[model samples]
Target: MESLLLSHSAFIPSQNKEVGYLGRKLQSSFYGNMVSNNFALRSNINSANRSVMISSVFGIGRKVKKVKKETVIPEPDYRIPIVLLGWSGGLIYADNLAAAVPIGLLGLLLLVQTTRVRFVFDDEALEVKVGEQLEESGENVFVGGKNRWKYSSFVNWELWWPNFPILVYFKETQTRPEGQVHFFPVIFNGKQLYDVMVERCGPSKTSAPKES
Candidate 1:
């Protein structure tokens, strides 16, 4: 009986140790799985946040607005032609027929051209077109000439006799690779033309006269 009791006590202690070891192993496994799951969840959240930030930044950049410039067209003027015709008449009255006849014809031609030609100043370019309705861009007198010229292509420009502008002259590389010079009688409003030229082409060497 004594021997049997001792054996039973030894068996009880061995079984208890086995049970404790199993419980400790199970607890460690549960904690390790929890820690791994938590780390994975955090990693996923960080990735989503990073994606949202990048998208938002790009979205804000795309939302920026651009302002559009308005087109400016100068009013038609016939002052140059009228002045020429009057001067021709004065010369004829003075009996200077040699110069008067040619000057009178030139004045008449300019008068006709004044009725047809139009200068259009748009946001990006200056366009010379013909007709009362501005429907026709007449054929360029020079070979390889273009009716339209961008302000950016202008090398230099001038309003001759700024106080009483009689001519408009500009040199540009748009028509020819080497360069091209153009001269036009100032048939448009001088003040309007000067303003637009200054605004679009930049400041000129001659300053505009102060307003009275």
Candidate 2:
């Protein structure tokens, strides 16, 4: 799971920003209620993954003083997607790691010069914060940059390689290099996030990938 930590672009932790654009949008909000949520997550993670799940999921969460965020889970399966900015080059998916090495390294240098990403959410949009997040575990730090994806702007999406899942939250306005797309992997308490998605955004639709 940590194999792609470099590639997993997501937010550190945030809540103050919600008072910006998202606050206005929450007026006509969708989720006005709460219910019991208990999802059956994959329980067989190794110790390393278990540690990650604990730290990222419960170590500390985005602090929202007035606004209510869902309960935090010490462990969950579906990690919220972040804004991956590398994982690109002129290479295609390969039959083995040997052929992919040089190509992966070529574009990965761009990542070294950049800060990691993280996730935030409001009634209207999913926020992926970018830039350097220095300080103690991102608890009180503010991310200097971010990306936005409004719920309505989204039409469909695909999650790549479940082993190291990549969120492709297709939107009407997306136009970036696929290389950058692979890094921002978001983590979340799966059940809570799903409940919000279903209620506010409506039920999710699923499909099989098209064969070319």
Candidate 3:
């Protein structure tokens, strides 16, 4: 078997001074009705941006304190995640005959959320330190087994809304998440990175698992 070294890193979006202001406006608008009476709404945007910026700049990770063990597998899946940004909302009406009203005014809020995708190798797992804001606050490391997508850890799983990305409800026992990771606007996408990861970790397993 051939041995290869892989790194756990994410592509950070380019820094923009306008991002902070733009984010605040959009988030305030979405929860306009929900948080109309709440004065602390503005603070939410600043806090969210602060966390999101740090995560994106550094990528979802922590220091590699030590290498417990490393091994290379035969196959790996290399799907590049696309980062969506610049959130916007639109209004629409949903008609339900079963409900009290035949035509109800429904504000269909369309928002763009930012994210980054990095390929994880079968033998490659990351030891991450999550902030107290997240469920797994302590120092944690996820190990990759024969299945690459079956990871043991994830960070900052949040719901991307118009202005701010909100953290979804997480239980202490639930292992898998229903949301995606928060990322910065600075995105790094090159054919070289994609090809390298895919070549190193291509999926050819006979059976597909339930979770990734």
Candidate 4:
């Protein structure tokens, strides 16, 4: 589970807003999937009497650490937290609007360096987080258990991002309001996720026709 989530998270393509790119949108999709999964997992944890705690963020420029498992979730700060859960899960954090200014400014100076954000999936849920390593720190979102995304709930998973090896999409639809929402799983277990989707959810109608 750990290996699959980490590989999937690492595989997510980073988008640039400079060229009419959809980085933010893509990021949103990833986050949405994370949330959907986390919600389901958390529900299960509650029912099963197990709990997941997220620590607060710490550390200096370009890096952060979680103080404890139940730490207050990041609020407008790039300071991401480290997630611990009986060795089954991990967490990641991203810059909030308030902290984005400083963090983004610093990010500009480091051009050559690269980091891998780690994400995880357990029996009950999914998570996104940075590791202790300097380059491998970011954000963690949780989804799971009762509230998990069912194959039916997701309308689609699109591959709109270029340059990145993998892209996933999720959608929610309603009759009252005819609209479409897209979600990406920034971090996931590529083969496992793909296999599960294919098995449980199947593919969307609009997906690029599989090359035969």
Compare the candidates by TM-score and give the number of the best one. 1
Off by over 4 Å in 2: 1-101, 106-115, 132-146, 161-164, 173-200, 208-212
Best by lDDT: 1
Candidate 4 per-residue lDDT over residues 64-140, each given as its tens digit: 55443221111111111111121112111442445554444444322111133333332322233344442322321
Query: lDDT value for candidate 3?
Result: 0.31
Order of models, best lDDT first: 1, 2, 4, 3
Q: Give the winner by TM-score: 1 or 2.
A: 1
Model 1, TM vs. native: 0.72
lDDT of 3 at 102: 19
For model 4, the superposed segments whose C-alpha errors exceed 4 Å read 1-148, 159-166, 174-179, 208-212
Query: Could you tell me every candidate's TM-score relative to the true structure?
Result: 0.72, 0.32, 0.17, 0.28
Indicate the TM-score of model 4: 0.28
RMSD of each: 4.3, 38.2, 41.1, 43.2
Report the C-alpha displacement of residue 208, candidate 2, in angstroms.
8.3
Model 2: how far is 68 from its true place, Å? 5.8
- Which window of ten consecutive residues has the lowest lDDT sum in model 1? 203-212
lDDT tens digits, residues 1-212, model 2? 66566344332224445555486566435333221111112333465577788878885555757765552221223222122212222234435456455545633532442234334456566555444442123222332223555666555544343344333343323323231222233243334444454544454367423322
lDDT of each: 0.82, 0.41, 0.31, 0.40
Weakest 10 consecutive residues, lDDT, candidate 2? 33-42
